[model samples]
Target chain A: MRNLDEDTITQAVLARHTGAPDARLREIMTSLVQHLHAFARDVRLTEAEWFEGIRFLTEVGHMTDDKRQEFILLSDTLGLSMLVTALNNRKPPECTESTVFGPFHVEGSPEYPLGADVANGARGEPCYVRGRVLSRDGSPVPGAELQVWQADADGFYDVQYKGEHGHRARGTLHADAEGRFHFKSIRAEAYPIPHDGPVGRMLDALGRHPWRPAHLHFMITAPGFERLITHVFRNGDQYLDSDAVFGVRRSLIADWVVHPPGPTPDGGRSEQPFYTLDFDFVLNPLAQD
Target chain B: MRNLDEDTITQAVLARHTGAPDARLREIMTSLVQHLHAFARDVRLTEAEWFEGIRFLTEVGHMTDDKRQEFILLSDTLGLSMLVTALNNRKPPECTESTVFGPFHVEGSPEYPLGADVANGARGEPCYVRGRVLSRDGSPVPGAELQVWQADADGFYDVQYKGEHGHRARGTLHADAEGRFHFKSIRAEAYPIPHDGPVGRMLDALGRHPWRPAHLHFMITAPGFERLITHVFRNGDQYLDSDAVFGVRRSLIADWVVHPPGPTPDGGRSEQPFYTLDFDFVLNPLAQD
Candidate 1:
């Protein structure tokens, strides 16, 4: 404890932390310190670089307020969010895989009935999204509650807007008696994440783009089933192969079929081109306690 | 790249970063990703735990401002700062060792002539600190500039005060022709770091104290020598064995000799008890570029 050098310092830190009352906290912090120290040693980090990291982190913190979360964005961009998602959501092979739950998901979104216009004046091409909630055995899981949200064509969520912008392109709905759900919303479009902050600067310096593929976020919950937080990415997005957040999955990708001005899924007439998407979600049973 | 699992996501992220133009940035990022992913996998970090960590980091960031750097404090408490210091500053067997450059050192401290009262009305027992600057071979390195600072008896730096509290217990002075220097300042005392923030809460949760051993910080510099950032710790401080920041080194400890009310080191009379500490600093030559 008195004369800690580079190699012995890690053990000293772990020794100091052995008194943590919470076993889980102790374990987590132990691994965290070991890996963090190893990272610094492996890089032979200089004082200037260390100070730069400190400055970067402080700026990230200062940039964070009630509306934006720069820390989450940093984690997402680093692929940590995806890794955590993968570790926590190990599901059956047939079930829908989960991805990074982007920072845009909000609680108490305006509730809409099946097939209603959940987009509610958001800017994008008209789209009809149809989906069914099913169990791993392919049987319907009726009345499963679905929380859906997505960015507008301009790549901004309702919260991202500075002023009072009513909720758009996001809402809550429930599957029908047959576990089928549909909603009229905007078509998903590729867009860059908020890149005007420190994280954006980091991405630029790293020669990496901040664009996430077009995707619709979904969070579904039902009785006797595990909660699902995932996204339905559009098939032909150029950024699909290099999603900034590493949130794209092959199973989550589906086609947004283009249609000429014609009858919609709800039997409504359309003068302009629109789109339709049909995808099914399979829920895993909750683990037995 | 699109279907990354927990283990594979690390490689995908590293691969995406391969386009970074800077070789140093590429190397640092590669190691960072590897260690970061290993930590998550080692802990099997869950979604809830990951979210908690994000929130904790956000709080740490929010707590930081122009004067307070919670991130640096976090690094210090976790021993990362010391590890970085040790890694960057590898002195010879006899040269003085470097330690954590605490967050409180401010630039532009009022300069003082030798034997001047640098405390400037700060509260603590009067102490005369005499020290010399020498090379590893024990030859004097005259006129070495020393920047010194320490906390008052209340365990608060001048910057910690909310209002206009002038600089106290800190100043800059230069060694004389014989590499000898002495200044009037306050005796160091064990004190808790700024603990009203998230880091404090974390320390409490880990069943650890927030107190650092009594010590005075010093940064010495001269031509043709490496800059040295170190501390002169009191020999018998209770917290020395378990400093909250892991900043204590055996060689840095020195005796603070107590004296009765009598003539002081500056040939001045003192009606109250005082202390004296004599220390020597050895600097290493600058590394060849």
Candidate 2:
């Protein structure tokens, strides 16, 4: 208990928390309080500005519901989501790098067999995606689980469409004995995240666009390896240089080969122009329990 | 538009606001983004911790309504409200110092005449408060508006009582030509801020008490001078050393003299024993229009 001045209040607050039951919680709270105070002092935050922040946060909270999470969107737009992902995902050079696990991934997507089309009732150019899951040593990891999802050409996920029950442009697939997996879906499209909320308003006020680069969301897991959540961005997408969520990486970007309506790279026939996108993912070993 | 790494994301976020129409808003936002990112970096904040913060903020938002504002409470407990008050109320040494104008003040309180008791329908130890509002040169400032409010002996403001109305223990008053003002109320009682919400949970987790020092709220305004929002804390209160809001200052503390049943210091006789509190407030000269 002390009459704390601006310079001493941070110390006083920290001292009060010395008896916290959890050491990690205490450490986290101390750092949080220090930074929170520093931020306020650094800017000499005004009462009016502080009130504005409170109101803005309340509005963001109110905007969140079953289909929307404005707070997560706020994190993404502020680059915190990506920064945390990078911090938690220090991997070997051969292992796939991770990105923001966006808010649209569903819990249980319908499983599909090899060469199945995931874009049911969705409209877009056909894209054939074939990938192999391997260990860091470049050996195939059979029975690896691949959970994949993406937005349609119209920039909305299957869950976003009203009255829609089935998952579109999303599916679960398994790697075979050779660790090979393939599926057909609509080409990934650069799309704006849900921008009708407070986060969208913030982006608009900042003169920033909300469009993410065209990419496929992937979460790969196998026995004796760490679960890897990553994204494979399409090459030459205009928004790649400025993905709204800052989720793109050079290694994750791959070329999409366009072929005439004929024999495909996997020996499959098609009537219209289709794309062939081939990539491989390497997983890092899981940590000891 | 660039793919940002941890080192570069702050600048990218700041650059997005170059086109803001309001210069002040732009400045505030740029500073906010920088500090926000710096805090995250300093803590090496994890995704789980970030999500916890989001959830805490969301709960705070849900707790706020027309009657409750947990965000303001959050700011007050964090010492931000007092810091901002101190920053904005820089005054000459002679002028009375200011503190936080807490959330309990109500607009259009019933005005009372000098020497009148403002504690109608409120129960507590009788206390007579006398003060003078003087200008820098020690001259009386007639008709300076003084808005005052405080909790009862039970540590509850009138607003907190269900079915209570008419602003008990609160009143508006005007200083006389001689700069004299006096009123009757109950002795200020140390009280815990509303602790049933997220802030309370945080305080409990940090092993901090939620009690504030006993005090009276005052907002003084004159036609020409800057408005002063402040508190007069009880000199010997137990919580003065550890006010939950960090709002106590040495200059604002004053002794409350107790008297047996008899003639009062102001020549007013009473059958019951009462306390007398005396103080003087010096107002800075009004800013030139």
Candidate 3:
């Protein structure tokens, strides 16, 4: 055997994978090996550092369960999740941009009608959310499903509060004949992500905070249109400019207008102050699926 | 708010870390984001593929435990460990080359005298191992510690059969006044790494195996010499050219001379056949403290 150096070792690694029957797998593995080697070289990572990484990854795995996804959190903190999202969702300017589908989402949320109160007494400032699901050509996408979820004012998802109330600040709504949908919920609040895990410790050591901007999670889907998983951030959120997960997009910011105690636009009387937010979502047509 | 495409979003992510006080953290994070984004772009990774990667990593993390280190195995298979090893251990050609410190090492091992048998009744061909510890200038390094461990001919480490014969095929010995040491052990054998976990599944999917070459692991240390972690592969082992961990180096191969059933060179009789392997290790001087 010839003495192997850095470059030849990398080449030897890549060459061994030539027999991978799947082309895509080979491509990904090749790039992954190259980039990983480069990262190690770029940092001159020491053995202790490598062992630390191993321990961190192990703890991240151990922290993961049905409710917590520390690996996704690690990826989010590292900006990998957003990078992958951007690569997959390259679209024209007219369409709504996408972001991370964070780990809090649950499938088959209860469907509600327009103006329905989905907050279920969760505490926060009262807010009215109205949105229209539109196509690229400004046409209504009636029957489009908007799966919405967000943390309560306490910054805890209903899942985190397990026994108190099931699935608070979460629901599914459909666009009407006019491609319009609305619901009532508490105003979203910026909150620190779960940082008690390994990823959290990593962020702290790196001098980065784990706060994501206040926003409502939305996964909108319609027939003949590409599904969009995104968030509607409150305009001028403190954390928007430095979202922990890097999921913020300027176009997804919603203007929340506060109102005096009076009648709501939906013809409902409110005893206390309330807020209203109106936004529109544009979905690109699915590419010949 | 403008819509975010790939480039703008990457910039935003990097910008969020500007407040990091440590310059090294900033540099590492910046390079990490760039390489990660580039890898995704190079592969044009799909959302499904991204999630698959996430799940794979999660499983790898879950498979890790006190005994099993799937992540290190993953690193080894991808040649990252060897790359880092090469980067850190660049040395003159005369100096003995280094390789990975595989996961089978045990601390506070039983110390044995020269010519003591380390393999206690393990089924394999009897072998005499003798080596010398020297400095870069060929001077003997007395009192150097030789921490030795390897799999028996049946390809099982002492740690594997934890309940049967605890701590077999492992011992630590020190160089004598002449920097010479010898030990009795079974012929080292090529062995497959643990293949029952997520890493195993990954190797299977990638059309690869988990077999390492026949070799003995050594960690030599002295007061003024840089620590040397390496392995001596049996010459002509089938897996020498394709070590599962990519840890083989030309200078680390050993020549094992076979002998007929007769009196051994160490003044011992062996009714069955036996072999002898003589090798020397050269340690580089310690770096300035």
Candidate 4:
């Protein structure tokens, strides 16, 4: 057998998989094959180098656990997660921009009524997030379910604190009859992804920094319509362009403006520092049931 | 913002990635994106479902250890390692055929002199392996370093056993001035990869079998030449066509016919069969360097 270069084998592997008839799948596989091969060829990978790569991935696997996802972190740092997220979601103008799931969501959040505070009195810049669910033609789709979850002001998810449950700023709410939803919550702040794992080692090797922009996570679902898991990003965060996971998008960016509000005691909770965002969502409906 | 189905989000992720200009890279990425996206679509992935995938991968990470690489096993079983190995090494005919490094190589291996059996005292049918290292022009390549390794008759490596110094089946030896090298070793046995980890779970999920054909590992290097890391797969192993990792190349298969030493007491423990095969390795000098 003739010796094949790195690119040739990649091409062959990719070749056997083409013509899947699912045009979307075809396009994606093609890109993945190309980039992966190029990355290998760019370095002129040696046998040892190749094995080393395999070994690195093996280590990545070993670093994963129930509480942490080093592989997800790896995909995040590599921008693969973001790249896939973006390629799949293209909203019509003026919709809430999508972001990565960020590997923190736990199922069956407590459902709250409309206008309730999801932040549960946590301290941070106060902001009101208001949005409406609508069909692609801009028709309001009332009574849709919205699940909102986010890391706390300290950048640690509720799950990370171990036994600290009892509502760590996560909840679900239904869109009102008018298709509008609102909630009072603290503004999202920039955070660092977990770095004490093998993913961190990989980042060190690649010379990449780990910082994500401030953002809010939302999952909305309507009967006879597709569910959307997306985000509204605070535009001014320093790590917007290169969110450790590359999750930022122009349409998703929201204004984190200073909006002072009158407040009583409780350490002047909202008296001075405050932020407000007026964001909306656009959704495509499932074709007639 | 509105909820989008997993397919839509997957597409959106790809859209955000700017296209690569390199033609080869572009071709491959296009396919990779397609396959990855298809996998996502095939499962009708959900935010939670995708998270579980991340979790599965995290467990894969958690399974890695210094002595064992679960991800390499994952890649090997999924046919990625071999595919990548084949795509990169484009050697001309008559050179040694390259194959994957079975995930057992430690950074340091013992060194031995020429004609020494790497398989020292391992109990099995005796086999004699001889090879010549030559350049493409048929010139003998003296001082060629041949670092050879193979699994035991029971299909477990010495490292896996943790007590043996490994049979003379593995060592680094320098070729003689005439380009000749010889070693004695027990015949290899087809082995099953580790099936207790996440990779094993993946194989179960994919409904694929796991079994690698018997083979001896070799790494041949000569100054100013392309190095070769390859395997000589046993010709009649049932797993040859379906080498769990897809590492079988028809050209690399070798027949080890039984040799009769006229009523030997060793095989005279004679229920065991034996064979001798004289294999040759020819490496090409790097054309540029």
* Best-fitting candidate, scored by DockQ: 1
Q: Tens digits of per-residue lDDT for model 3 on B91-112?
A: 8888999999988999988899
- Alpha carbon lDDT at A33, candidate 2: 73
DockQ of each: 0.88, 0.54, 0.67, 0.21
Clashes of each: 0, 0, 0, 75
* Interface RMSD of the candidates, in order: 0.7, 2.0, 1.8, 8.1
Quote model 1's TM-score. Answer: 0.98
Error of 2 at B215 (Å): 0.8
**Model 4, position A75: C-alpha lDDT score:** 70
Q: List the residue pairs that clash in candidate 2.
A: none
After superposition of all CA atoms, the RMSD between model 1 and the true structure is 1.2
Q: lDDT for every model?
A: 0.94, 0.86, 0.87, 0.69
Tens-digit lDDT track for model 3 on A1-289?
2467887887888888888889899999999888888888888887887887778788998999888999899888887888788888888889999999988998888888888988977778999998899999999999899999999899988888767566678999889998999999988999999999998887887778999999999999998999999998998788877788888888888888899999987898899999998889999998883
Q: In terms of TM-score, which candidate is strongest?
A: 1
Best by lDDT: 1
Give the alpha carbon lDDT tens digit for every residue of A175-249 in model 2: 999999998998989999999988998888777899998999999989899889988999999998878888887
Tens digits of per-residue lDDT, candidate 1, A1-289, equal 8999998999999999889999999999999999999999999999999999999999998898888899999999999999999999998899999988898999999999988999898999999999899999999999999999999899888888888878989999999889999999999989899999999999998999999999999999999999999999999999999999999899999999999998988988999999999999999999898
lDDT, candidate 4, B30-126, per-residue tens: 4545555555454444445456667766777677777777778866654457666766667787776678877876555778876566777665678
* Model 4 lDDT per residue over A251-272, tens place: 6787866755666222345646
Which candidate order results from sorting by TM-score in descending order?
A: 1, 3, 2, 4
